[model samples]
Target: MARRKFTREQMIAAARDIALHRGAGRVTLEAVAEVIGSTKGAVLHTFPNKLTLLEELLRSMCQEWDRRFDEIQSKTTGDALSAYIETWEQSDPQAPSYLEAVAVARAEDPKLLEPVRQAYQRYGNLMQLDGPIATDALVAWMACEGLVLLDLLGLHRFDQTTKDAFFSRLKAIAAAHNGEGT
Candidate 1:
């Protein structure tokens, strides 16, 4: 049988998976290769080393997140703010812990910091909520990030009452912005 032909994107995703679950420093060329049943040579065909691999993964993740927000914005144009809130709450399990590696990259390599900032910028522009609603939107995103991090790090869990309270606050803020009563 011939070796499987994995794209650069595939390798990057595998690297992200390894980094998110195992830890940031664990994203070696050999580890990603094993995840995809490839070889270090194959991974290096796309990335020169672990740093290059991590950089590619971070860039792709950021760009993909931006694209997702764009899609949500277009899909629910009439209620983009609501759509954004829902998407924010429903982010993937891998995302929160994924930030762990990205944060490490901030200090270890210069390339990592920009993607996080860019991703947030894209999300904000797509949200298109103004004034107070924008502030609430930021709060919602921050809360979701906190929830995910807490869960991933085994630190804390947001009880149902707390989660409900957050949703209530966010929805109330959005409702008020839309000229409705929450």
Candidate 2:
């Protein structure tokens, strides 16, 4: 049987799956090879080491989110904050946790959080681009972040009705700040 050769994307996805399902501590090269049905040497050839593999996975996840946000922004006539809320609301609740990557990276080296931190800083900057709505937008953004953080940590679950009300209220706030009254 010919061994399946996994692309970089496939390997990173497998590593993320391993981390998300089994806990971040389990994202070893050997484990990834087994998960993807490739050799340990094949995994190493792509990632070189566990830290490198996980770091790339972290970066890839952030980039993917940014890409999705850009796509959302381009498609919606809504303001950035409202679009952000919608994006969060529409995300898959059962998707693999990117937070797992952050946890593992932080444990290995605090510096590994640089990419994550930078992505957030960029998000903050983007939220501030609207002059009139900046403050209210940030409030909405923080509120959305709180909800998302709680969900990500598995600390809270709001029913769809409650979430709809929450997002509607935030959207109204953003609209009001733009002179479009609720």
Candidate 3:
């Protein structure tokens, strides 16, 4: 029998599937190894420990968000706020899984959240929001965060009609504040 070679990306992807489907708490080295049909050593070689694995997963998620945000910013000729709203509209469905892993990692060690924190801080700076529009931008931003939270926790879902109304209001705010300050 030949030993299967698992690439780092393949291992990470398997870990993500395990975290999302089996639950974040269930994302163990053994679980990942089992999913990838590899030895524990193989998985450990890619990720020294479970914490490292989760941290990489969270970091990748944040990096992906930044990449998408940049893409949105580049394609949009509107204000930063409007670009941000459009970016939010293109939210990744897999975000909740990464968020769940963040929760688990944070519960174990608060320092694990540094990457996520830094990402958000950088995101705020990139938004170029200030002056009169800051308030509206902040409100719209928080609303999007609330929506992500609701989706992640599977607490409550907004029907299409309600979501349409909410997004209409958000778009209005974003459009109104598009080029107010800068």
Candidate 4:
């Protein structure tokens, strides 16, 4: 039989799956190799080290978030804040979240969060509008992030109705700040 071939993306994906399901502490080069049906040497040939693998996982997650944001922004008639909120609203609840990446980063090295921080900084700049309601826009953006954080941390206590109300209110606030409507 021929040797199994695994791409860098496949390695990273296997690491992500391990981190998300088994916890970040469970993700190791050997574990990833096992998941991908390869050898630890094969995994290292691609990642160089466990830290590199974890960093790549976090970077990939950030890149995926940027792609989703851009896709929503392209279709949105409102401002960046609105696009950001809509993107969160449309996210898959069962999908892997930033929390998983964050856990892995925190477990391996705090510096792994740099990609996440940079992504937030870029989004922050995009959400900055030139108007008196800039603060309102900021608040709206914070609220949306807070909602997502709560849900990710499993601290969200609001029922579906309350969550829907919160989203509706957030949309209205974003619209009003954009000078569209309340």
lDDT per residue, candidate 4, 115-145, as tens digits? Answer: 7777778888887755887777878888877
Q: Candidate 1 residues 79-172, lDDT tens each?
A: 5556556555566656633355455476457667776877667656655656655676666656666776787666886777887787667766
Each candidate structure's TM-score, on Cα atoms with residue i matched to residue i, is: 0.75, 0.86, 0.86, 0.88
Q: Which predicted model would earn the best TM-score?
A: 4
Best-to-worst TM-score order? 4, 3, 2, 1
Q: Which rank order by lDDT, best down to worst?
A: 4, 2, 3, 1
lDDT of 2 at 50: 85
Where model 4 places Cα greater than 4 Å from the true spot, the runs are: 96-99, 129-131
Model 2 clash pairs are none
- How much is 170 displaced in model 1, in angstroms? 1.3
Model 2 Cα lDDT, one tens digit per residue, 1-182: 77677899999888878766786778789988999988999999998888898789888877777676778878876456666767776777544333544666766677888888887778777665467557787788788878977876678989999999999898888677556784
CA lDDT of every candidate: 0.68, 0.76, 0.73, 0.82
Q: Which of 1 and 4 is the better model by TM-score?
A: 4
Comparison by lDDT, 2 against 3, better one? 2
Better of 3 and 4 by lDDT: 4
Which runs in model 3 stand beyond 4 Å of their true positions?
95-101, 180-182
